[model samples]
Target: PAVVNKIAAGEVIERPASVIKELLENSLDALSTRIDVDIEEGGTELIRIADDGEGIPADELPLAVTSHATSKLRQADDLFCVQTMGFRGEALASISEVSHFKIRSRTAEDHVGSELAVTCGERSDIRPIGCAPGTQIEIRQLFCNTPVRRKFLKRASTEFGYISEQFTRIALACPRMQLSLTHNGKSVHRLPATNELTERLTLFYGSQTVEQLIPIEAEHGGVRLWGYVGHPSLNKSTRKSQYLFLNGRYIQDRSLQHALNEAYRGLLMTGRHPVAFLFLEMPSDQIDVNVHPTKSEVRFRDQQFLFRLLLSTLRTKFLQSD
Candidate 1:
């Protein structure tokens, strides 16, 4: 069982950035209004996430690290409509399998908090402590025991770059959540909760970049799309700026990309991609997010309809601006 967990951990945690992504998702799942992420040595030496959300009860601290123990899914039907971010129940368990994990949590009912520590799948300690009314998780020496895995890690700078990108992606998806990131004790990003999408974009990109974008809002056939689409003059050499969120979850889909590009056809230069941050909202039953373990790809029931809706919406926006 231990060996199996370690193997699964490798799949779920490809690198230090992967670990940060899982931790951020878990924090978001906790309904945290404010989340702080701190990392060192590209997250290999240490990674910490603190969230101001509903903390776990003292009794549930131990079980929280147990395999397949999740609060997100109450029944089988919940799988079809997973609105929460961390539902698989495998993230903490798998992460603890290969790292030194510790969690301190205090619920509103508790006067004091409880702390649990696990070292590479073995419980080291569990005790009561003083803490704020929330959860703080610290992971250290990630992949230290797995020499082969550690060998595959990139340099600290390169790995940190990936971590930064992941942080931006999560921040973009949840613009109304207060999020901050620190690396080696230096502040990387500090974003306060705001309902304005353009404000969040300005924080990542500059004010000039935001000015180059055009607002998009449209609703049709039980689906709604809203966000900022870059003008043709603001096209990029890479598609990194193209972000699509379906039902509050960031996703990558070729069909949606094709639709977007088609909307920009004849407007953009060859080999250039338009910058966009689009959010699509529809009934949860109309799409499926369980196709992949990472939940980065989703399947829509009516792909053609969605494509047409996106294309037409962007085309109309472009035409109006012109």
Candidate 2:
């Protein structure tokens, strides 16, 4: 039986932030070095993502916004050895299901690309159009199909703040991507591609935040951890600022998060959280990247070793600063 792709989109694309995350990952997967994001009224009105990478072909344009369609993977084994940031292929479809979507894309080989317009998972128009060799996606009236979801939304200001933080985290992780974001027609962030991670960190966080960073590096059993962490005195009022990435992908593993906090045991005041931005790199086979639908959570085969490694590396950083 052929399942309805429309119903599935409702589960995958729930909010504006979710749409933003998926589009950003697609840009990264396309090896795009530059990505521009523009949003209006916390994405309730408009959200647009433009990337200068290999765009979809005229024929693939329809499938690109169809459920369960992906250019990232083909087989079950590919899931285990994942390298690209996204594989579900549900983002575009999901976003299209709940909002007004228009995709203008062109491939290098074709003189003319195609434009696709979809409303709530229904195709209203698909036509050939001349455009640059890249992708531009515009979404409007997010979550319009699901009135219940809209009811639960926070204030526009609060939602925009969350979106800003998400983009900043992604920018910091992928310093090589020239990222720009705007809110309500005003520019809020513009990060040019740079080889130096420190500069990106400084730009993402202010100069004041960078002043508190301490560099840390550790290698054990072929795996290496490298990055910066905030000083004990610079503990944040909340844990939102704390971040960790594994091979340039942001992740949240309970084991890893606990190991980090345990390393800062006595250094942190009660209820305060220390900030971190560390990258853990190892053999791809050693980690299971398919644990989460969003690809933000990973499960390691040797969980104990990773936990210990994270704790020891962080502890050494704190000790050296003493």
Candidate 3:
């Protein structure tokens, strides 16, 4: 079992950024409104996340990290999920297999919190601890037991860059969630909770860039789309700036990507991609998000319809003069 767990960790956790994404997802699943993250040595040494959300009960702490013992979606449904669900099953288990993992959490009703620690798949008995009303998780020495995996890690600066990118994606997806990030001992980002998406855009991109963005809002055929699309002047050399969130879950779809490019076809020069922060809302039955465990890709039931809708929406918006 230990060997299998280590193998799974190798597949799921490719880097510190991957770990960051999983932990952040868990926090969001817990309904955390405020999340604080601290990283040391680019998350090779330590990564700590504290969130103010409903915490795990004392009795459930063990099951939370149990391998392949998911308490969510045990039975496959005929239709794609009607709601966006967090991937909580193998994440904690795989993460614990590769690093020193500890979790301390308390609910509003509990007098005290419970703490659990796992060192390379060796879990300790749960113990009571004093903590605030929420959850705090610490991961230390990532890939420590797997020296081969650790060997492939890039430099601290480069790895942190990846972590920052992941953080940026989540922050943009959930604008109202208070998020803060610290590296080593210095603060990198201290974003206050805001319903305003432009505030986040300005924080990540410059204020000067935000001013040139075009706002899009439209609904058709039971699908609603709204977000900020960068003007042609703000085109990027790469597609990294494009973010499309479906039901608040970050996703990647080739049709959607192609549609975006097509929308800016004549506006952008060759080799340049449009900068966009697009949100999509539609009935869950019309799409299949079971494509990847990472939840980054989904299959739409009507691919051509989406492609045409997205392309026409942006193209038509750009045609109108502000």
Q: Which candidate ranks first by TM-score, i.e. highest?
A: 1
lDDT tens per residue, model 3, 30-125: 788999999998999989999998888899889888876665563343223323244548788999999999999998899999999999999898
Tens digit of per-residue lDDT, candidate 2, span 1-322: 1235546665666667778888888888877778999999988889999998888888888999877788785444344332576657778877888888999998778898889999877796679887878899999988777788877878777778878877876897888889999999999998889998889888767789888998888899888988888999988889877788777778788998899889999998899998888888887777765575664787888999989998988887788888
What do the candidate models score in CA lDDT, each in turn? Answer: 0.87, 0.82, 0.86
What order do you get sorting by lDDT, best first? Answer: 1, 3, 2
Ranking by TM-score: 1, 3, 2
Error in Å for residue 55 of model 3: 0.4
Question: Looking at model 2, how many pairs of residues clash?
Answer: 0
Runs with alpha carbons beyond 4 Å of true place in candidate 2: 1-6, 74-83
Q: Report the error of model 2 at residue 220, Å.
A: 1.6
Looking at candidate 3, the ten consecutive residues that score lowest on lDDT are 75-84
For candidate 2, the TM-score is 0.92
User: In model 3, which regions exceed 4 Å deviation?
Assistant: 73-84
- The lDDT, on a scale of 0 to 1, for candidate 2 is 0.82
TM-score of each: 0.96, 0.92, 0.94
Estimate, for each residue in 59-144, the C-alpha lDDT of model 1 and write its tens digit. Answer: 89888898888878544324433256674788899888899999999987899999999999998667999999989999999997
For candidate 3, the TM-score is 0.94
